[model samples]
Target: MDDAASIDGDTTRPLSQAELDALTDQLIDKLKTVFDPEIPVDIYELGLVYKVDVSDDKDVAIDMTLTAPGCPVAGDMPGWVEQAVMEIPGVRSCKVDLVFDPPWDPSRMSDEAKLQLNMF
Candidate 1:
């Protein structure tokens, strides 16, 4: 996913669909590295990530949530996610927002996460 918007000289242009797609893949890969600490699966697979938006300058905004409102690491997980996303080369900035609008449910977990947790 390092290939996303990795232009040689001009980086000020608005992201093309291809660049956005590649950047999205990179973002997902980075998100996959962040875990809930208590869960064996990463946050991405757990479906904690709600939305991701990338700016023309490569700034990233993410909306995510916890499995439970009272989760202990609630104070630290967003920072972890932001840090991970910032590791991408072309990313100028990263911001992670915690949201509970729809809340989280086991139904949100990916098939791989379900298999990992034996939810099936």
Candidate 2:
């Protein structure tokens, strides 16, 4: 193992672009671990997350939304997403952008999410 790997006690090789993409996916997965207190499905599956951008410096920017314009957790979900992104090993920073442009509807949810929520 190399010095950095040894220091981290990780045996995996340094990540390439594909590996980094995988890490980004894993980071997204971690973000999904959190859920809207009122909803059974993850925000990711709910299509609340519109975009995830990772910069060259490993900073992450998330554009997300709530289930409704006046949801109770509106003030907190972005912070939750920020916290989740920051947990990624190489993430230097996280910025959450809360949006309502397209607005949220049941149709935005993933098929699995709809199935889980029995919306379908």
Candidate 3:
């Protein structure tokens, strides 16, 4: 239980390495639960999730993009991601940002996603 003391009774300090690692794993697990409606694979595997940043206070910020900027679910997918992130027990907040600078391409996808999509 002591090892789980993320706050260490001081919220101002940064989370320990172990805490960060655990939280990161949990965040990825949560992110993997969110999916693009049109895609059978989760957004994480699809490479839609560009970045995930966690603040000292356990706030999560995500940068993600869609298969296409005009995709039908663009407006709702971020919320789905936020919902998934907020499910983590220790997460204090979640924010999802949609970005398009480096537009999505097949190259970003994981091998598993490629296999699932039959993109071999």
Put down candidate 1 lDDT per residue, 6-120, tens digits, no spaces: 4576546678899999998999999999999999999999999999989889889999999999999999999999999999998999888999989999999999999999999
Each model's backbone clash number: 0, 0, 0
Q: Model 1, poorest ten-residue lDDT window?
A: 1-10
What TM-score does candidate 1 reach?
A: 0.89
On TM-score, the stronger of 1 and 2 is 1
lDDT of 1 at 93: 92
TM-score of 3: 0.90
Q: What is the lDDT of residue 31 in candidate 3?
A: 85
Residue 28 shift from truth in candidate 1, angstroms: 0.7
lDDT tens readout by residue for model 3, 8-116: 5663566889999999999889889988889899999999999999987888999999999999999999999999899999899999999998999989999999999
CA lDDT of each prediction against the hidden true structure: 0.92, 0.82, 0.90
After superposition, the stretches of candidate 3 with alpha carbons farther than 4 Å from their true spots are 1-11
After superposition on all CA atoms, what RMSD does each candidate show versus the true structure? 5.7, 6.5, 4.6
lDDT of 1 at 86: 90
